[model samples]
Target: MADFFPEEELLAAIDLGSNSFHLAIARLDHGEVRKVASMSEKVQLAAGLDADKVLSLEAQQRGLDCLSRFVGRLGSVTPQRMRIVATNALREATNAQEFIDKAQRILPKSIEIIAGREEARLIYLGVSHTTAAGGRRLVVDIGGGSTEFIIGQDFEPLQTESLQMGCVAYTRQFFLDGQINPMSFERAKAAARKEVTAIAAIYRETGWDTVVGSSGTIKAARQLLMQQGLTDEQGHITYAALEKLREQILKWKHTDDIYFEGLKEDRKAVLPAGLAILMGLFEILGIEKMGYSDGALREGVMYDLLGRFRHEDVRDRSVQALMARYYADPRQAERVALTARTLFEQVADALKLDEEDGDLLRRAAYLHEIGLAISHGSYHRHGAYLLEHSDVPGFSKVDQLRLSFLVGLHRRKLRVETRAQVLHAGGQSLLTLCLLLRLSVLFHHSRYDQVVPTFVLSIIDEKTWQLAVDQHGAEWPMLQADLQQEIVQFANWGIELDIVQLIKAEIEA
Candidate 1:
């Protein structure tokens, strides 16, 4: 298997949420993921972001401490079968990579920062699986740094958006010092409303058969409403119930002074901000009621990971969609992809490239020429920009950037500086993959079924490679020129690329 990890094994997902960190472990059973264990900690990572959006040293330490505890509880889950995702806080933090570097030391898996819309899609996925799969539903999840709004039916999300307004962030902005006055509440509500206003028109027009709330904020609100007798036994948060909670919340002079039957000590500080955001959402989106769902982003990640095992990987679908949307030359893309995969197989073991790397190279090959749809000149750059910015679902922010970088490096004059930049981030494996992709793309430059000669790639060491191609292919003047240029390009990147033509004497009789 190209993938080192086995599918259908016990899988885990860790959500580095803005308000809290959550860990969930599950295993596939009868085509469904059955939860084995779960835990959460209120690290409140977003609360630590400074005005410059840098996570404070203190906050970083707190998060590290929490993950350390989680590490102990991880037991024996393989890192390959696990995924850790960070939400809005890390996305906003300028120094997130530094934090991630530190966190990766203590955790079993590398943390991936997901885009907000992707977060929305995952939230909806988790909700759909946990709830009934019928009718159109609007899913709202209020996190510490952002609020995600997703409209979908069944398991497919039609529209997903994330706004930079969340409980912890708003609390810091409007309810700092824990003081809560009607004016402060109004300000928080108004600010949240402004954020929602941008998408309200379309969301309202699209409408929904039901509204679903997921996340700690929504879950807490529902619990509080139920305990306060503001909501029915079913624990649904109605407009009337929301209004009652708002009135009661405004009665408190400060978060510290607030006392309610449903409030937890840890949730008190951020509840007011969360409530205000929900109030704004209710007002602007015309939501009559909302039911809380226990499933959320982490669950969605688990399902997505499971999908990879099930051969229904959404990333593949996303790649195909991009190819179609950009009017990519499917035939040429297939040729490049085939060539790339074949080249990958030749050096994957020596280069330490895994199945994931192979998948990445194939996808990059398929989408490499998408920018041609925009313009042939600098199409690589254009394609990179589109991949970098487009809302390709199922791709993490880092995944998009890596794909962008690969596409950017595919056809350009190999800049030692640019090569160094990629090495600094991705190290040697990425460079090797890029080399393979470049060769594959180069060999298929004719864009036709020119018989590609048999080739053998041998890795001399980490920094040196030798390629032996059939003399028949070497007969092509263009191929010879391309290979000569590639040798220079590889040298620029501090790697030796030696090309040789197979001798007729060495050919099998």
Candidate 2:
């Protein structure tokens, strides 16, 4: 038999959740992934956020300290095979960059702060992969700072929504004093109900066959219920059991007094708040029972990474979806993407570009004209706004911003602020990709099926590039004029673009 599991074929994912940090390492055997190791720590990162949405230094340190230990447990998992994802806490923190910069120093991979919808999608991916399929299923994950809800079939998510209500955040909001009174619990439930109301109608309209819960909050609930003999044989939490658990919790005057068999001390503080939110969901959504899953965001990240390695990247699907949604011309997109990729190959070595960079350029090239769907006037600006703001699945916040920078500056005069933004996002490498994309778009300005003249692009130095075109071609004059204009644009961006005729010997060779 062919070797299904190669030596050291391991993948890792780190989930920097608002309340805890999780590290999961898995090995790919055959077509399935089996967990090799896992670890989690309740850092309560969201609990550190002040009223101003600023993450406190103490919380930042707590997160960093946890990551420092996680890094030690990484073992043989290389940086390229690992992904770090941050959820609601980092997304809401005003000074998140300050925390991320410090965390990056401890871990080799940079942290990706995913949008809420994207987080929901990943959560569903993890659940669907781990659990047995049953028509359509509703997956809910109550985290530290946010709760993600997803309805999916098998491995595909149908509807996804994220609410900015979580155990840690709600604890701060309604249970800071540890009081478990009916009024306080009702208040918490009312607040949760209000948040759920926004998407309740649509979710109920598109109902599910089974209800599954993931993440630490729900997992803790199931474990505690099982310990108390409140769960069914299948380990599902029923509405009756949930109510009974609530009654039990309300008997305690404070969080410290709340006690249950098999309940970890660390989970005590957030248990009441988590129960309130879950109960609120059950009442509002009319859910009868919920089955728990060990899978969650970190597992989803590993599965996503595996897809990338297996040539089934979801980001490509997301890009195609965006293009189709914006009514982009596939032919034009193909033309520009092909040309951009060709240019990328020529200077990739000098620019230190890799397959990932090439992928970004290709996607950006295909989407450069998405803004034309809105209006031709400053459509680049419009397109940039759409890309940055759109809840695109399988893309991180930084990925969207970098893509926006390329599309926004593809045709217009490059602004200093735009350049600064691009530099801050991906630095010189991204700028080079932008330059290549611009040249490709310029070459196909006529939007015709006619072939573009052969051109050889070479790097002269860090800030200089030389492009030798076939001067004898029929479209030479028009192309030359376009190049001259592009030269001025490149100069504005502090890059020199030198154009010359293609040498006969070089062309023939």
Candidate 3:
């Protein structure tokens, strides 16, 4: 993990957890991140989950209230630089979009609800950066609603897993009765172990140089252990210390009553489940001792964000890697991109499309055919399918869906189903972009060794878009037919499509 970005920009990461919301602000100093400020609010978002996995009104308000305060602290981050990641709570919620829409309106940045495995990767990255970089390490981060485990050598993560075990969620399941007993403790520990069982064999095989832990739960546990004379000054969490802590926790008969030294009141109820999960991880993976790191997901996100500004963007690399892995046609894709961009410029003034659209259109054109790897039969459709299904690193699900839908609908006969998917994934703007992409693909469909048709396209009114095509040596009946087909297809997108031929004498008016 060489530092990928220049050290000029200030970076920040906000992790919206189920039990807590955190902000970590730091500046890149030499080759390391030096923290400027940090804050956490125990929002208990996971416990606020109702029977249907919907965040309760109280929980929603709590999150909103926290963001309102955080918005002030955000100060100067552009939407692109600041990353707001929601973990398991929004992943499980049916109405996450509702909350997301509200949050986006309040804040400058878009919120990314990452998958569990991605969360694990970032946790490892952050922990590795803050801890010693030598040797392979097993890192565990138990949060409010999910637990992440990773085995990484130096900075590169080898195995990543996220389990449905967390302090807040487990506390709600077992300790909500407020009458924790030996049976409840056993049940919580057993449940956590069951989740960890899925990855035990692989991680055991991969092994680790040491075991490390992070996050509030682990931090609290380390303090309690040291204060109780269970661990050393370096915060190496050992199996013996874990068992001793378990015994002490069981003696209380309730998480509330287990008041060991250095325990905070807010962490009192949730600490036992976190400890149980950590203990289960240690026993399952056969760990001797583990260190701790203050760095976790947020720190990793800040570094990643800075990478984008400094032109070391992981998203761009991920895209290029995916294209290579799928054996996509670079030359042909470039041709299409160039043609699409030419058309984009012609329409930019008329359509009022900004630089953002130009960038998006170019990317969509580059990846318009990745699904060919799956099958040549309707390869465009296949490419769309792969994009929507595969977890291309650095991409959110929504971004993949939109890109895939654009590629999927770029060709073939348009239908209502296509329109619905475009609308669902991207709404009205997506539908318009899909129209633009289809036109570009159609213009370059022949993929002739010659240059694609240069064209001017403009939105004439709220419902009408017109394309004026420049002659390419000779009139192309194939392209003309494609254009006629597009008129019908554009109707599906609720746009009136017009095609007009251009000659040198006629200024394409």
Cα-based lDDT for every prediction:
0.87, 0.91, 0.80
The numbered model that scores best in TM-score is: 2
CA lDDT, candidate 1, residue 197: 96
> Residue 359 in model 2: shift from native, Å?
0.5
Clashes of 2: 0
Deviation (Å) of 253 in candidate 3: 2.2
Inter-residue clash pairs, candidate 3? 211-290, 371-383
Query: Candidate 2's residue-wise lDDT over 1-509, tens digit each?
Result: 12133535888999999999999999987777789999999999999999999999999999999999999988788887889999999999999999999998889888999999999999998888889889999999999999999999999999999999999999999987777789989999999999998999999999999999998888988988898899999999988998888898999999999888778888999998899899999989999999999889988888888888777889989999999999999999999999998899999999899888999999999899999999999999999999999999999999999999899889868765667778889988888888899999988988988888889999999889999999887778898999999999899888999998899886886
- The TM-score values for the models, in the order shown, are 0.96, 0.98, 0.91
Candidate 1 residues lying further than 4 Å off, grouped into runs, are 1-8, 473-475, 503-509
Report the Cα RMSD per candidate. 1.9, 1.9, 3.1
lDDT value for model 1: 0.87
Candidate 1 weakest lDDT stretch, 10 residues? 1-10
Error at 94, model 3, angstroms: 1.1
